[model samples]
Target chain A: MTTAAGSRTLAHPGLGEITLEGVLHAFADPMRMRVVRDLAREEGAELSCSYFALPVSKSTSTHHFRVLRENGVIRQIYRGTAKLSVLRRDDLDALFPGLLDTVLAAAARQAERRTAAGS
Target chain B: MTTAAGSRTLAHPGLGEITLEGVLHAFADPMRMRVVRDLAREEGAELSCSYFALPVSKSTSTHHFRVLRENGVIRQIYRGTAKLSVLRRDDLDALFPGLLDTVLAAAARQAERRTAAGS
Candidate 1:
C-alpha cells in the first residue's frame, strides 16, 4: 500500500519477524554499519537518503539501505519526493533490549580509536 | 610457534586488532553464531573441536571456527590431539563491554520465542 507521502511502499520485517542473525548480518558491512551509526546518533530522527553523505555511489548507497531495511534494522518511508530512513529503535529495543545501543557505542569507540591512532 | 599441546597453531587477531565490523561479520553466519552461542553458555570452559556436534561436515565446521578465531571472537589452542576452542570473553568484554552478553541473551530470547510459537 502506498502512503500519502509517496507512490512507493517499502517492505519492512515486523518486530516479531526480526532475527538476531539478520540484524548482525545487516550491520556486518562497513558501509551499512556507518549508516546505522549515523541513524543511532540521530536518536530516532528520520532523515532522507540525501542526508547521508556516504562515499559510495548512489546505487551502492541504495543497496546498503535496502540491506538495512530488509534486515529490519531500519524503516524506510517516502516523504514528499524523498525516501526517509529511521532506525527501528522501538522494535529492536523490545526484541533485543540494548543491543542497538551497545553496538552503536562499540562502533563509536572503535572509530575514536582509529582516529586517535591515525593522528 | 608450536606449543606442547600440539604441533599446529592457529592465527587469532589480537584483542586490540579486533574491529567491530569483523566481530559482527563473524557472528553473521548462523553456523558461526551457533558455535558462539554454545561457547558463551559454557562460560569460559574450553572445549575440544570434537565436542561440537555441528550438522555440517568437518571442513565446514573448521571454517566456521576459523572465522571465529580470526575475528577474535574465540581463541583456539591445541591440546594433545585435540584443538580446543574457548570464547575470548575477557577480550571481547574489554573491547566492547556488554556486546557479547547482549547478543547471547538476544539469541536465547529469540530461540525461546521460536520454541513457544512452534508449540
Candidate 2:
C-alpha cells in the first residue's frame, strides 16, 4: 500500500515528555529562540533547517534542532534529502495553551524594542 | 543612617540573564516542577523550602531551590533563620506574559490525569 510511503513518519513527543525545562532550554539560546519565533510567524510553513540565520557551527545548529524535536517544540519529517521542520502547535496547545503564542509575541515585541533602542 | 538593614536584597537576575534556557532548565526536574506548581497555587504565600514533600535529600533539596531562585522562577529572601521562597510572578509575567500560569495549569492537569490513571 502507498499509505505509508509518501512521508517519513517522525516521532514527535507526546504530552508526557514535554517538560517545562525542556521547552525553555530549547528556546533559551538566541539562535534557537529566533528559529522558534520564525516558525511561529510562518505558522504551517515547512521550513528547512538552513533557513535560520544562526551564528553557530553546522554541528551546533544540528544539536539545537535535535533539542527542539526531542522536547516537542517542533516536528520534523524527512522529505527526500532535506528535513521539513514544523512547530508542534496542536500538541503544545493541548499541553500549555497560549504559551507558544505568548512567548512568540513577547519575543517579537522584544525584538521591536531592541530595533527601536538601537536606532 | 540605617539603609536597607532588615532584608537581604537578594540580587535576582534582571531581564537580560533570564534566558528561556535558564528558566526551562531550572524547572525541568520533577521536584522543581512540583515546587513551582505549589508556589503558583499559593500565589503570594511565602513558602519554606522544607514545605515540599520531595524525595531528594536535604542538600539536594537546597540545590533545587537554588536553581529555581537563580533562574528567576522564584525569589528568595532570608527571614531570620528561615529562607522564604516566592514565585516571581510579576517578573515572569512581564517577561513572558501568561507563560507561567499556562505551564502551572498544564502541570496540574497532568498530575490529575496521572492520579486518575493510577486509581
Candidate 3:
C-alpha cells in the first residue's frame, strides 16, 4: 500500500516491546502460522501480502497480518503497491535465542506427522 | 478431587490429540503461562493447584488450569483432596521436542526484562 507521500508504513512493536505471550498468541492461529511458516522458510526475504494463499477472506487475511505485525513476529513494509512481510528472525532470536528455529522446526515436524498420519 | 471412584481423574488430551496451536494458545495467557512456568520449574513433580498464589480468583485460576489441561500442556490428578498439576513434559517433548523448554526460557527472559525495567 502506497500513498501520495510515497510508501505507506505499518506500525510494528519494537524488539523490546515484543512479549512472548503476544508472539505465541499470534502463532496460535492456523492461518497466521501458515504465513509465518512461509516467511520463515524464505529466511529474511520480504514477500508481498498477495503471495500468501490464505484460505480466508481478504479482510480476515489482513487481520491476521495486522496481528502478526502488532505482535512483532513479522515486519511489514510497503514496496510500491505491494505490502511485503518479513519474519523478524533476528529480533526474535535476539529476544529469545533459538525460539524461532525451535518453533519453525516444531511446526515442520507437526506438518510431517499430520501428513504421515493422513496417509 | 476424589469420589467413590477412589481418585477422580481429569480429562486431558492424549499425545496424538495435542496440537501445536492448542499448546501455543494455552500458553498465550498470562495466568496460564505462569502456571506452566511453575510446573516446568518442578520438572515432572506434582504440585497442588493451590501451590501457587495466582493473582486471579480461585475460579479464574481453575479455569486457567482447565485450559492448560485440555490443551495437553499439563496433566491434573487427584492427590488426596488436592488437585495436583504436572507439566506433560514427556508427551510434549515427544510431539514437539524442545518447544516447552524454549517457551519457558523465553518466559523467564521476559520476566527478567520486565523486572529490570520496573526497577
TM-score of each: 0.94, 0.83, 0.94
DockQ of each: 0.88, 0.48, 0.85
Model 2 Cα lDDT, one tens digit per residue, A1-119: 56665466667778786866677667667778889988988889999988886888999998898989999999998876778799998988887777788778767766876788689
The sequence of per-residue lDDT tens digits that candidate 3 reaches over residues A12-31 is 88888899999999989989
Candidate 3 CAPRI-style tier: high
DockQ of candidate 2, scored on C-alphas against the true complex (2 decimals): 0.48
**Candidate 3, residues B41-73: lDDT per residue as tens digits?**
878889999999999799998999999999998
| Candidate 1 pairs with clashing backbones | none
Q: Kindly report which residue stretches of model 1 are placed more than 4 angstroms away from their true locations once superposed.
A: A1-6, B1-6
Candidate achieving the largest DockQ = 1
Q: Report the lDDT of model 1 for residue B27.
A: 85
DockQ score, prediction 3: 0.85
Report how far off residue B79 is in candidate 1 (Å). 1.1
User: Which ten-residue region of model 1 chain A has the weakest summed lDDT?
Assistant: A1-10
Per-residue alpha-carbon lDDT of candidate 1 for residues A1-119, written as tens digits (9 for 90 to 100)? 55565667888898888999999999888898888988888888999987889999999999999989998999999877889999999999999999999998899899998999999
TM-score attained by model 2: 0.83
Query: Fnat of each prediction?
Result: 0.91, 0.58, 0.84
lDDT of 2 by residue, B15-90 (tens): 7667555775676678888899888888899988888868989999998988998888999988766788999999
